[model samples]
Target: MNTVEWSETLLLDFPPMDEVHHTFVDLLALAQAAPDETLPQAWSAVIDHTVRHFGNEDDWMRRTRFAAADNHIMQHKVVLNVMREGLGLARAGNMAAVREMAGELAVWFAKHTQTLDAALALHMRSVQSDAPARRTNRANEHPVSAP
Candidate 1:
């Protein structure tokens, strides 16, 4: 089985948000497959992407006045802190520690998306008539529409 798999059940049903969520799961698989010596580098990339993804989600939640915004943001902060600690250990050559942390992260991510993100998506849809614009495939391209 795939170490990290994305399913429709994990999708928040918001195009841009779902795209980011999918990317995060893809990164987790990459992290899991990286060579032991290169795991830190793989984790660094995951951390960067996660930071950006969480920031984008939190900003949208706050702007849209999501009722669970504060709680969701707190969870993001906690995840980031955990990642930071894992990275530090990995940088120190603790491969086993890093692997353990990655395992925990995979489970945490699956559960969080199923609960917090699912609720966020439902709330956003209830509050807004139009869905958020889909993300462009190109990194440099500007989004055609706003959330």
Candidate 2:
């Protein structure tokens, strides 16, 4: 069972995403090493954080019109569902399932960040390059109405 940790290799060079990834890794570590009594809470925290993490990425994909947004979002949905199921198993006193899920997540997250997230990060940077201009254009076209 590999313990996930924040490392140079995990740095995506995208601060917001990197920060979220770091938090995720830390939470996963906590869950993996937690005492049996603490495992459920720790696992739940990971699930909650994952929901937000995946939601943000999914939103980014949708907003940026990423070419593979559907596939990427579907993967997130599937993984989250599995994690949620693990949570249920954990609550029912299946600590082994929770521990196994944590290990699986460590592997999945490494690949996910390196590939799908890496692509999304590149797309986000591309969109950011034009964001200021787009915002200015929108502001001009739709001036704020005074209250």
Candidate 3:
């Protein structure tokens, strides 16, 4: 099974996103290494993690108005649907399909991280950086009167 080994290159500076991504890599590895008897369960775990990961990132994109949101969300939906299909196939005694998809997913993950996820991380950084300043400005604007 071709696994997406986590490396510095895959690290986004954003801690929250990085943590989830690390979990994704670890889960993917587990799915790839799983024996035939346990492949369905292992693949299920990957699918669960991926669903949450994609949902969280998609939500972040919507909240921040990320420029590339449409494409990113569409990709997430498409990949997830395929993963669900693979899960069904695995459950129906077609573990080979899940194994094949695991490899393909590894390739897709790397490319998606480098492009869509990277952009979202940068947008998150910018949005977070501005948040504190905006709050400070608002505080100054509404100074309390002397008691």
Candidate 4:
């Protein structure tokens, strides 16, 4: 299977959120590469990371009182449910089902980032500019030079 990749252009311009988004894509790539026998473990890791990322986003939205927080949270719930059901199929060794799930995940991430995350990122910038400034400064100061 080809590795799934996300480009920097898709980032929401928020350091923490962008990092988590990239991690999610990486996890998806790992899941796609896992052998049938190890698929369950790989899927579990993806689910765990997804849940954590969603939770972090939810917390930020709630703390900031973003207007569409409820809607975004609801979308997260739907995605999680879909992922759980897909994991069940993967655990049963259904390769076709897993592939379908991966496709759905990729589409969902694209839409979610463009719509929901874009809105959140804008609101966050308006309300939390200081946080991003600090994050950008830290990232600049400790650039991870390629090995």
Put down candidate 4 lDDT per residue, 36-131, tens digits, no spaces.
888788888999999999998898888777899999999999999988988899878796787768777877787888889999888877766465
Write the candidate numbers in order of decreasing lDDT.
2, 3, 1, 4
Tens digit of per-residue lDDT, candidate 1, span 59-102: 87887788899999999999999899989999999988888888
Q: 3 or 4, which is superior by TM-score?
A: 3
lDDT of 2 by residue, 45-84 (tens): 9999999999999988886789999999999999999999
Which 10 residues in a row give candidate 3 its minimum summed lDDT?
138-147
Off by over 4 Å in 4: 1-3, 130-147
User: What are the lDDT scores of the predictions, listed in order?
Assistant: 0.84, 0.88, 0.87, 0.82
Task: Flag the better candidate by TM-score, 1 or 3.
Answer: 3
Q: Quick one: best lDDT, which candidate?
A: 2
RMSD of each: 7.1, 3.7, 5.0, 7.7
Residue range 1-147, candidate 3, lDDT tens digits: 677799988888988889999999999988898898999999899999998999999888887778899999999999999999999998999988899999999999988998889888988988887876776778857442210
Supply candidate 1's per-residue lDDT for 82: 89
Would you give me the overall lDDT of model 3?
Answer: 0.87
- The candidate scoring highest on TM-score is 3
The superposed Cα distance between candidate 4 and the true structure at residue 83, in angstroms, equals 0.6
Sort by TM-score, best first.
3, 2, 1, 4
Q: How many residue pairs clash in each candidate?
A: 0, 0, 0, 0
